[model samples]
Target: MKIVKAEDFDLRREVEYGSPEQNEAVREIVAQVKQQGDAALLKYTEQFDRVHLTAGQLRVTEEELAAAYQQVEPSFVEAIAAAAANIRAFHSRQKRNSWMDLQPDGSLLGQIIRPLKRVGVYVPGGKAAYPSSVLMNVIPAQVAGVPEIVMVTPPSTGGTEGIDPYILVAAAEAGVSEIYRVGGAQAIAALAYGTESMAPVDKICGPGNIYVALAKREVYGVVDIDSIAGPSEIAVLADDSADPAYVAADLLSQAEHDEMASAILVTPSPAFAEACRAEVQRQLGELPRRGIAEASVRDYGAIILVDSVVEGIDVINRLAPEHFELIVEEPMAYLGLIENAGAIFLGPYSSEPVGDYFAGPNHIIPTNGTARFSSPVDVDDFIKKSSLIYYSKESLLSNGATIMELARREGLEGHARAIEIRLRKEGKAGEAE
Candidate 1:
């Protein structure tokens, strides 16, 4: 990994995530799916995922779902069930009830919270299997009372046999039945624009490769998306008191994700930076995904030297990483100083993987500098809100002329007339200026 001063570090490296050709490819996929429906979906699935399927074979069947349980071990099943329980318990706290408020003007004003009727969750299945993503994406929708949650994952090989057993088992545990064996930008297109075999969903959520990310970006306005997720990133802000081995291990965890993934360390102590960098090089030799991790760390990863812990916090906020680990002497004392991390790990014990798997928080976090504006996937992602306004005759009569005046100020005669007609009927056209 490269070691540099804070002034030499570039924030722009993480900001620009993908290429234009990737965006254009996603656009073509979305356009074709919208035009040809199942035909285009199946064709692209074959081209991208190497899986060819008929209309009937596009969707996973009940028999396949049942066989998934038999293929997976009992212990694995129990573990997912437990994880689901924790995920459910945490998201249940975010549940919102439709509420009403009675105003002094005798008007009923409130907000109605309603879950999307159906949602689609994309779980990456080609190079890796993230069953944890299934639990993260579907559980919140279930908590929000989403009636139907459909899941899509690319088939493992060119053959259209079935999905990864662990993924199926996780989907089953999370109460997602409508699953399709498709992936890449094609699967995203299929979800955003319904094919003959599938129905269009209200919202789509999950993470994927660059193709998947670009597809979500293309189809954003047509259907709601959680966020334009980027490559996985982690930043560790540590001091001399922190563990070099632990910090190295944590940094390598994200580094192994992909070549584009970023793993950075910021510290004031020069000795600690050298120790951690050496530890990372040593550990990288032992990892199975060493080549990927090595490339990520060598390319995007860095160890930045700051003047102090306060200066480290300034750099963290400037970069706004998706995951942050604070390994200073008093992690909590500097908690208020951090302003831009998607998820913060306060102490040495709180590793990033803990939140990725067993912890209650959703692991589908905003990436890149997006943490400055966006948030992690939660119950709010699966539900929609409607502002409720029941203006009584008295309230309207008293405020109608004021509204008309404002509308007229904007030169919107139609809007002013709409309010004027009701005020005149109520015999209060001249009321409230």
Candidate 2:
């Protein structure tokens, strides 16, 4: 790892940027899916995944799930069940109820909250299967009262590295009604447009490769999608009191995700920077994804030594990291200053992985610099709201003329006439004679 002062503009810029090819490819994939539906999906599946899945095989059977459960150990199955309960408990608090209010003037106004009729969740099975992701995606929709939830993953790669049995166990625990043995862009297309076997979903959530991101972009209007996720990243704002080894390990946790991933340490202590750089090397030797982590650190990692912890925090807000860990002496002191982060890990004990698995919070977070405006996945993603309004004769009479005048001012004669017609029906306004 290389150390740079916070004043190094070029290095700072590179750390925050991402490649744009994913966006363009996503546009193309979405179009093909919308136009051809399942046919295009099957073609892509065969090309990308090297497997052919007929419509009937698209939905995983209960018998297959039971076999999957039998393949995993009892202890692992119990852990997934416990994790599901925690996830469900946290998300249930986010449920919104439909409400209506009566006004003094005999008007009724409010909004209705309704769950999406159906949803599709994409779980990546290529590099690793995320059973935790299965829990994170399905539990929220269940909490929102969504009637149907379906899941999809690439067929097992014929190795333990392919799709972990834990992922299947987790999905079953989370109440996913349907599972698919397909993945990549084709799976995303199937979810958005629906094949003969796959039902069309109102919204699609979860994570995948660049092809999947492009596919989701292509099918966005055809079906709602979660934000286009980028490579993983974590920014740690630490001081001299922070542990260099823990910081290095935490940063590498995300760095190992991909070469494009970023892990930055912003601190006031140059000594801390030196120690962390050495610690990264020490830990890299032991990491299973050493090549991936090494490349990520060599290209995008940074040790930004600032003048003060306040300046370190400022740089973090500027980066708008996907995950922010505060390891200062009093980490909570800067909590309010954190304006842009998908999640904040306070104190040394709260590692980023906690939120990824056992923690109650959803792990599907905004990536790149999107934390500036977007938020993490939650129950809100699976629900829709409809605004309600009702007016008494008197309330309409009071506001109708202003509404008509405004509409006419905008050169919308039809809109103005609509209001005028309403008022005339009540004998409160005159028609053009």
Candidate 3:
């Protein structure tokens, strides 16, 4: 890890807009799925996934879902069930009801909240296949009351011909039975533009490779998407009181996710900074994924020297990391000062993986500095809100003139007439009464 002064380090990396060739390839894939429906979906699955399948084989069978339990350990099932209970309980608090406010003049105004009818979650296959992701994406949608939650993953994972048993077990535990075996950009297209075998979902949520990300971008207006997620990131704002070994381990947890992933440490003490830097190198040699983590720390990881803890907080706010750990002696004392972070892990005990796996909070968070304005996936992502408006005759008449004035000032005669017509009829009715 490179060590630099807080003023010298630059956190921004070039945003990934897939290359022209990749974009064009995704566009063509989306277009094919839109045009040929199931045929194109099957064709692309065979070509990309190297697994030939009939349209019937695209959807995972009930027997497969049941047998997946046989492949996974009983302990795995217990852990997932416990995690699901915690996640469900946490997200249940975020559920909202439709509300209407009545006014003194007999007018009604409020919002009508309802869950989306259907949603699609894309879980990547192979090395990226994470059971935790299945729970993170599905449990929230279920909590929001989304009735039909569909899951799609590649037919093969880690050179195996079937979906990972752990993923299947997690999905089953999360109560998602509608599973599909297709993947890549084509799966995204099928989710957005429905094939003969599958129904189109109202929204799609999950993470994928560059092709999947580009495919989501291509079909955005056709259906809602979760986000264009970037590489994973973790930033630790620690002090002399923090353990160097523990901090180094937490940073590597994210760095091992991808080569583009970033792990940064900001501390005021020069000795603490050196200790963490050396510890990261020592631990990096022991990791099984040392090559990937080494490249990540070499290219994107850093240790910044700050004048004080307050100055360190300022630097962290500017970085707006996806995962932030405050490991000072009094981590809570500076909690309110953190302006931007997708998820905050306070103290040494709250490691990032706790939130990633079992800790109740959704792990599908915004990355690439988007934490400044975005949020982690939650119950709200699966629901929609419609504004409610009910104006009484007297209320409409009272506000009609003001409405028309604003409409006309904006040069919209049609909008003004819309109010004028109602006002004229209501006025006549009132006069007769």
Q: Candidate 2: lDDT over CA atoms?
A: 0.84
Give the per-residue lDDT of model 3 (tens digit) for 235-284: 99999999999999999999999998999999998999999999999999
Tens digit of per-residue lDDT, candidate 1, span 1-433: 8899999988765355468887787788889998998899778877876777888888898899999999999999999999999999999999999999998989999999999998999999755799999999999999999998999998877665578999999999888888998888888888888988889998989988888888888888989988877789999999999999999999999999988899999999999999999999999999999999999999999999999999999999999999999998989999988899999998999999999988889999988788898888899888889999999988888778788889999999999889887877777756633
| Residue 194 accuracy (lDDT) in model 3 | 92
**What is the C-alpha lDDT profile of model 2 across 74-104, one tens digit per residue?**
9998888888888888888888889999988
Q: Which segments of candidate 1 are over 4 A away from where they belong?
A: 14-18, 429-433
lDDT of 3 at 242: 98
Clash count list over all predictions: 0, 2, 0
Which residue pairs in candidate 3 have backbone atoms (N, alpha carbon, C) closer than 3 angstroms, thus clashing?
A: none
On the 0 to 100 scale, the lDDT of residue 6 in model 3 is 89
Question: Residue 39 deviation, candidate 3, in Å?
Answer: 2.0
Q: What's the lDDT for candidate 3?
A: 0.91
Q: Give the per-residue Cα lDDT of candidate 1 at 405.
A: 83
Worst 10 residues of 1 by lDDT: 11-20
